[model samples]
Target: MNDTQSVNATSSNDTMLVTKQVHEIEQFETFGGDIIKNVRVGWESYGELNDDKSNVILITHYFTGTSHAAGKYHPDDEEPGYWDSIIGPNKAIDTNRFFVISVDSLVNINAYDENVITTGPASINPDTGKPYGLSFPVVTMRDFVNVQKSVLASLGINKLYAVAGPSMGSMQAIEWASAYPDMVPRLISVIGTVKADGWTTATLEQWTTPIRLDKNWRGGAYYDQPPENFPNEGLAAALALVTQSALAPNFFNDVNAQLLAQADGKPDLYDIQQSPVIVQWLMERARGRTTSMDANHLLYLVRANQLFLTGMNDDIEQGLANIKAKTLFIPATQDQLLMPYHLERARDMLKANDKEVELVYLEGDLGHLEGLSGIAIHSETIRAFLAD
Candidate 1:
């Protein structure tokens, strides 16, 4: 087989196929008492916007994603959406009937170009008139949703066709349904549980370690020199952690193989000297993140995920009771990262709440990636659910 074919052969069966773009938005607020007046959000849309705008689908992004969901920014572009395989024309998302939208999460630190408006520790504080850096307030999923909520309000949208996402993004999606049950009609959570597990909390800290150790990090104040020139050791380490096990174990291995092939067979070596994509970006960016956000916020979002007792009739059962929209929970059968039981738990929770919930177990070796890579396996399922 040719090199590209060989690479494709080892890839997870579910791959995205669509065009995407990075966009920016301005003037947003968060629950953490911080207001980002000019927020940069990279976004992508699929299908035409209906005249009533009721067909709009909002996709919440994970911690590291930009708003580049599906289709190319321009006709000649080659890159597809991170989850393109599942959402497009007649694909799982069924662009023919719905207008799909996905936006970059707050403080997104990926390969997005500078034109995308973003605010993190890297952004200047409007109050002090200086970069917030480590001084930026800590944020949470509610804070994130608050910002997106502002975006939706600006567009005159009071309700959403659906709110969907994975991993950290899934946490926000669930919160959107629970926190604003009056505004959402459906929730599609893949390979994500209601609460952040201890396993996740511990693993997430590794992403923050690298930035803390860099001398140039200057406690998040190295704005004068090249931000890229600053110590990226922490970010590199964090990237390695993600590259290794953030997704399903088997799928992680599959992607590992593809990434290795892209590196011409040199394994375990990320391009650090030549790029900022190494594992250290985690630490460099996470320095102010942990503190800037309220410890209560972390406890809230995480506990909300962990406490996602969908089936249990306990305190705040009213929240689950209020989720009137149909729900779909897709879990990776072989997923070691999230474990099949986690999604099962979510299914049970919603069912116990007497909510209309459907469970679709994705079959693939891609583990957690099944949530994304296995989009083809879910096209009919998603279409059917959305149609209802």
Candidate 2:
């Protein structure tokens, strides 16, 4: 075997600090009819699987998140996992009582980060001995859930007590309940929808425009070039747009107001559109993200999110009816991406079909990101739901 095969040979059970492990699935066929000769799924487990393998909770990750859902990779690390507030020993998910697992999505943009292992545009194609680039197959939420099922099977887990996630992770959670209803008994979908509406699809497409228009993009085949030659500008611009959509308008305005107030003596720009402070902040944030993300991987994730549907088909009613899990829809009131109306629509359909479902509105100023920032405020509510 060559270098690629050697990487694939690493065991998923191997543990390194607080980072995730890798499980290689050989010769996989994607939902889009593309064949992936080898797929590396990065996953991390907290707590212990019970003897009967029943007390399991799968914590799917949001966009840009890795499988490191809890604990610190290094003692000096500045932050813990994204959902660390809810996944510890006595927290909402309660690792002491239930085993928790998180997996990095197939084309996760953060695959370049040492903590994650994933097969994406950057990975070497065993057959061609070159980066897959745009040749990496487009995947849907169902495909992500299917891979997670393999992870569970590898661990001897036949059923999950609950599957919970926020944003893109919530999409995977919804897919899991719909695609494998028998496997998941409970699902917590926070800031997510059952289907990607036309508006959502169009918005996602717009996010990719900057990347596609970038000269260095070269149809996703620029990986062999120098770092500076990659589509950093386009990726940064796309991320800036993403940040704008992720926060509530009021929250951004308030932040700008505070910044303006802080510079009391300075001349008021008066024009929010051309505010130097806001533009600088957005650019800096996007630039920081581009430092760790792979452009092609980000594009793949966007496409996957765009094509998400509950049933993996266009029949929304039937898809809602197919979910057997006791579902909870937590929509952030200020979220512009996955709006409250989307969850309301799903709740209405599930109720009409006599499926067990509940809708919970998360009132917050953080918008889509509230799914992470507001967890502490709703910890009790989530804990109660999980217990039930």
TM-score of each: 0.76, 0.92
Candidate 2's residue-wise lDDT over 1-388, tens digit each? Answer: 0112111111122222354566778877888888888888788777777889888999898887877777776666787788888877778888777888887889888866877788888999999999999887888787788788887777767899999999999999998988888998999999998888999999888889999999999989998899889999999999999888888988888887887678645445785655477677788889998877898988888989988888887887777778999988889988988899888998888888888888888888889989887877778888988887
Worst 10 residues of 1 by lDDT: 1-10
Output the number of the lDDT-best candidate.
2
- Residue lDDT tens for model 1, 3-98: 010100011223333333333445555554555665655455666667787887888865455566665544445665677776776677867777
Error of 2 at 304 (Å): 0.9
lDDT of 2: 0.83
Residue 353 shift from truth in candidate 1, angstroms: 1.5
Candidate 2 stretches with Cα past 4 Å from truth are 1-17, 262-275
Report, for every candidate in turn, its global Cα lDDT versus the true structure.
0.61, 0.83
Model 1 / residue 104 / CA error / Å: 1.7
lDDT of 1 at 123: 65
Query: What is the lDDT for 169 in model 2?
Result: 93
For candidate 2, the C-alpha RMSD (Å) to the true structure equals: 4.4
Residue 201 local lDDT, model 1 = 61
Looking at model 2, which ten-residue stretch has the lowest summed lDDT? Answer: 1-10
